[model samples]
Structures are given as C-alpha cells and as structure tokens.
Target: MKTAVIYNSDLHFEHKQWESELAFWKDELKSFNNRLGELVTRWTDKDVLAQLEHYQNEFILHGNVIEDLQEAMEKHEMNISEHSNKLGDTMDVPMFSTHKEIREKMETQRQIYADLKKDFFRFLSKYM
Candidate 1:
C-alpha cells in the first residue's frame, strides 16, 4: 500500500527553491570549465596537459549533472540558459578553420585567461 505523506511548509518551501539551487551549480560548472579552457592553451607541459585532461573529464561529468538539473528545473518553469561554451571536452580545440569570429571570442575571454595564469605555475607544482 502507498501512503500520501505530507511535508511541512518549510520542507515544501525548500522543494520550491530547487531550481534556484540547481542554477547555482550550473553556473559554477560553466565558470570552472571556461577557466580550465583558458588554462589549456597556455600550458604545453605534459603533466599539466594530463591534469587538464583529468579536470576536463571531471567538469564534463559535472556538465551531465547540469543537464539533469536542467530537466528538474523545467518542471518548475525555470531552466539554466545554455551559454556558448566549447570548453572541457576531451576533444581538441574547436576548429577555428580560418575564421576571424573565433579571434573575437578569444579577445573577449582574455581576462579569464589572464586570471587563470596569475597563479598557474603554483597550481601546477602540486602535480609535479
């Protein structure tokens, strides 16, 4: 037999906020992926590449979680909007193929790259 259990108002309110909570993790995943991409172009060291490969996989896993969160958010009439981010894929750099449009995007993301590089060497030391 199935019973209809009742939730208190506080618990009900928390359930209503599920979409907002998921949006937080979704945005955080995007930020971390972008930062890791910026760092990816700068480091040519094998170990760094290995670490990047590892984190890229981790964030890609998180991306799947974001997709699940998105499905949940839809039931609440809210969803995390998709940003045009091409990072954190185990695949190689997105094919630029003689396009100036990508250069424009790179210029816009310059600040993120600079920020990631500021302490990048220190961050790499741990794996070495």
Candidate 2:
C-alpha cells in the first residue's frame, strides 16, 4: 500500500528555490566548460611547455581557476546544504545531489596539481 504523505507548507517555496538554483548552476557550468574549451583550443605544444615553466617559476599562478571552483563548492556547502544538527532536525533546504560528484572530483584533482607545485620546487632545488 502506498501512503500519501503531505509536505510542509513551505515545501512549495523550497521546491521553486531549488529549481532556480539548479538552473543557475547548470548555466554556470556550461559557461565554464565553454571557456575551458576555448583555452584548450588555444593551447599548443609550445604553450603547454611554456605554461609548465611558468607554473614552475610562479606557484601562485597555478590552480587559480581551480580555487575559484572550490570556492563555489564551499559556497554551496555553506549556503545550500541542509543536514541534521545536534537536535536531529533537518534544515529543510536542498543541497547539491550526488550528480555533482564529478565536479567535486575535478576540483580534487586540481587541488592535487596545486599541491604538486611544492614537490616540483623541492625536486628543482635538489638539482641546484
């Protein structure tokens, strides 16, 4: 038997807000992908080697876009996620779903690259 469960009065509003947030993020991701593609198209073998050198010289220049993406994720964690508190009450808001796992993983890879800069420096220093 199926039971008809009724949601809270605010559920409708929350649904609308959730839809809007999903749409906004979808657009944002599309834009980001387009920009990334443009960068890839402009990238040549020489450009790739030069960028590698630049990264070796300036660690701070690396992973800036990755950081921006992480900030976006953090913003979602702060503003969107609604989990239970100590009182065992739910926060009645919709957070990103598991489908966003890919995005999270990509960000993690970027972070790894950022961390690798330290290793790169250490390796270079040993040769000096």
Per-candidate RMSD vs. true structure? 17.9, 13.1
Which candidate leads the pack in lDDT? 1
lDDT of 1 by residue, 1-128 (tens): 99543223322244346545556656766776676778788879898888788767765665575565445434322111111133321222222221223234334433443454444445656533
- What value does the lDDT take at residue 17 in candidate 2? 52
* Worst window of 10 by summed lDDT in candidate 1: 76-85
Q: In model 1, which regions exceed 4 Å deviation? A: 1-5, 8-12, 69-128
Q: Pick the candidate with the highest TM-score.
A: 1
Q: For candidate 2, lDDT tens digit of each residue in 24-109?
A: 54454455445444544655667554544554344433334445544555554444334323323333323334315525555565
Tell me how far candidate 1 lies from the true structure as C-alpha RMSD in angstroms: 17.9
Q: Could you give me the TM-score of model 2 versus the true structure? A: 0.32
**Per-model TM against the reference:** 0.47, 0.32
